[model samples]
Target chain A: MFGKVVIYGVGLIGGSFALALKHKHLVREVVGVGRNPHAIARALQLGIIDSMASTPEEAMRDADLVLIAAPVAQTESILAAILPHLEPQTVVTDAGSTKSDVVAAARAALGAHVAQFVPGHPIAGREKNGPEAAIPDLYVGKKAVLTPLPENAEHHVERVAQAWAACGAIIHQLSPQEHDRVFAAVSHLPHLLAYALVDDIAHKPHADLLFQYAASGFRDFTRIAGSSPEMWRDISLANQEALLGELDAYLAQLTTLRGLLAARDGAALNSVYANAQQARQRWIEAIEAAEAPPPPPQETSE
Target chain B: MFGKVVIYGVGLIGGSFALALKHKHLVREVVGVGRNPHAIARALQLGIIDSMASTPEEAMRDADLVLIAAPVAQTESILAAILPHLEPQTVVTDAGSTKSDVVAAARAALGAHVAQFVPGHPIAGREKNGPEAAIPDLYVGKKAVLTPLPENAEHHVERVAQAWAACGAIIHQLSPQEHDRVFAAVSHLPHLLAYALVDDIAHKPHADLLFQYAASGFRDFTRIAGSSPEMWRDISLANQEALLGELDAYLAQLTTLRGLLAARDGAALNSVYANAQQARQRWIEAIEAAEAPPPPPQETSE
Candidate 1:
């Protein structure tokens, strides 16, 4: 699908894309760009990249695609750096968690070449990070969202979609605004809550004892708290408005829950829990149905 | 350990206790008592109980041990029902999630015979419920906390501990007050938060779309919300004061987090996330080390 690809910040998201493309013979070469020479060297040693690009100019030469998979804070700088080197034919995209911020950054940096840029977020995240954590099938069966710009050519959007498809991702598209709002409620809010929970528990006087008693439920509930701090910080800031909106909504929900508990209203409390339980049960069933393999064709009863 | 063992409310917790005891040969006869005749008959059919007791009178006749594994709200009534049939040698214990409430219930119902009542909470909850969900090994390697009262005999507490130990649980003791407070922070608070989150998302106008996008992180974060609503509702009320305290503390934490987001302090945000990440990482390590089989005896290479 691609002859050569340049990926900035070749960590889990970027490296995984590289491997997925290569494994399917979709991309001939993967050139990794990073400020840290040590990390660049390690990615090369790990065989996640075909070569190291010391500069965007070197990375973009003969490259058909450029993917900025760095933290959201770095997207602007990476876009600016690549702008000077981007070829007319190169279709640029990103794997940023937040789309509105990345869209703004690309518009400001790419100028006339903004049409070449396509914004995407592959809704696949793990607590683990860095190059070694990348897997070839990381995007398989995951949602890869694309928020295309008005200036972008139809062919460029198609090119980005095809690349993700090659990685076995299911593609969906939405406007930048809707993407941020939806993710703010579902993804970003959960991450912040998880982080807040862990921070709160960790700071208590008997934190050691509290943690000692935190069993499987706590482990699962707070697993996202173990994600890369710098990356999440960037995301939390970049998507601040939407995220804060979500926080307020969640706070309101909790306040209502508190009231029920304070009043000792067992019926109301049970109703809330039962509603949540039914919704979650439906979700689990949907997931299971999707994951179950199709049954074999039945024979004719001649 | 004794001839007759009567268990009120033969659901997951109660049924599992019966199977665990019978599996280990710690008890000779297990008598099931329930308001629902079908459930009692099912327990007997499952071989979880040696016989079904239609009433507390029948259940408590010559019973050496009585375990109230019903909902916290029902504990008092069950205690009262069994009190009329209590034998001087019988040891009574409960498996409520909250300790202080159970202690109060025992005090009210058992009166002068409260010395026989030992309050315990097995931190072995699953999202599933009912007699069908019972498992013999559910409490194995889990913490079974006993909150012995001042009125209780030491041997009575020991007998309660021995029963849980026979079920493969590691027993710990705490004052009822301390147990409720700690659990309010670690266990109950998480359950409320999980329930609140799911309820919030499930109520949105675009709830279907939102749920479609909800991924693995959301799955783990909301898993506890799938728990039995009736059971959790009772727990929330029983542990009301302590749970409200934890909820308030959590709200304050969220307020601080909101302030950070409003200010967009990237460094501060990163620090909080990093602290939480480190604490959670430490917790995961501790749990793993405990779950891991003990290292093979160190080599004595001469």
Candidate 2:
């Protein structure tokens, strides 16, 4: 648990982190730092943090941990800006979707102290924005991916893991490159596809009628399309290589499906659907099983 | 208003239609039919219909209107089986997803009486099944597409339109083929994609880890994938041609996107996302505006 945590960029993730810390009695003081004066005021009014600091340096002065939660594009610059004021023992970390660039920036800015930094990504957010949307239970039962905690100290990694555990997050460790590639397939590329589909639908001449006929299926598939463009633009850029790779794979699969459909190949379509059906069934089962409590151990002769 | 209507297959749509008819004082008698004896008993217990019949023919014996609300694949056979008992004056219509096939089936089954059979598709259904999922407002603000009416009695088409209106649906007319093509793009292909994606994820060796990291975005996008597989399978087969065309178009677009991503063309990616953003924004705006009340008409006293 973090005794004193300073959260940078009091947006959705950062604000949620403050609440989760409070829920677990994990932190004594929660201070927020952000560029927007109004957002800082609102976060204070909403009681998301105990206090506000005018600058990142001011916020991290005596903090045991510093969590830089900001737009991916701004993460490196913020890390560089805040490095000079960090305490030698303070564990610096970030909650950014993309990690490679941020890790490189942290190493450059903090030098030897770079070993204290842990790059993490929490897979949770809503289309709605601001501190108001932050819920203490947002991170509960969610996965938090930590990329390559430096070999500097076991205590540092343990402390970071404990912070995530307090918020009810299951921690998974991977290299920064692995983290990027995996998320590109699961998250970033899907978001890009949703955005593109929505745009295509909008530009159609029969847009109004088409949307009117769009069922809950279309609405749900395109909900992420309603997300902030600026944030996604940065993410799509930061993880370009992996995202492109994923996009190619998905397109190749889509093309095969199209071919089957075009030929009116019922047998082929059925095979594809059956494969998908079995896959989804397994996922659904896995999710349901995870929600249930663990089974008691079987009795055995000693 | 229908003085007495017989609803065949008293499931979600049929049960909801019973409620709507009662609410609008459109029907004096609402007889329900189901092949299953238990389902008939259950419909009666739920007060979704005034009485229950064992077969579609028996239900329509004395009814002014006969509504076929069964699955799309069963539409033709059900029509064929009921044709012998139909009254010449009765206004028979269907509420299936694919209009052309059902319309063709009606023509084949009922011969000249097919003119009384208006092929329609209602754009309403939850991820739920059965009468218990039935709600009076199920079709409220949803679209009900009626294919071009056959050269028959004008009053028959008017009767069909009124039925949908009473159920709180906005009526739109299109050719049977047009309805199938449009819905193939907006509904069928989207569902296919969702099922495939969820299936693919399920098959991954690290599926549990992937699912644990699944957020609300993925859950929403894949909700339709949780739909009744048999039902979706039937729809996929019924609208094979148009659905295939849509699949091809969608694949082509995805291929182009993949190419741009592979090339690491930031500008192209940015443009794609920008278009998607603008399209979705306009769609939301249009939908909102439609849901709002119309402005008062100006009077010219010249």
Which candidate tops DockQ? 1
Note the clash tally of each candidate.
1, 1
TM-score of each: 0.96, 0.86
Best by lDDT: 1
Clashing pairs in 2: A199-B276
**Model 1 C-alpha lDDT per residue in residues B44-117, reported as the tens digit of each score:** 88998888887777877788888888889999988888888898989999999998888888889989899989
lDDT of 2 by residue, B1-302 (tens): 66778888788888887888887777888888777777778888887888876666676686788888887888878888778888777888888888878877888888887887887777888866678777888889888888855565778888888888889999998898878877887888878887777666665676666665666787777777776665677778788888877777677677777677666666777777877776777767777898899989989898
**Candidate 2, A1-302: lDDT as tens digits:** 56678888888899998899987787899998888888888999988888998776677788898888878778767777777787877987788888777777777777777888888888888877788888898888888888865554778777788888888888888888878877776688778878767766666687676776787778888888777776787787788788877776677677776676666676776666766666656666877887788999989999
Q: Candidate 1: where is the Cα deviation over 4 Å?
A: A295-302, B298-302
lDDT of 1 by residue, A179-285 (tens): 99999988889999999989998899989878877788888888888899989899999899999999999999999999999999889999999999999999999
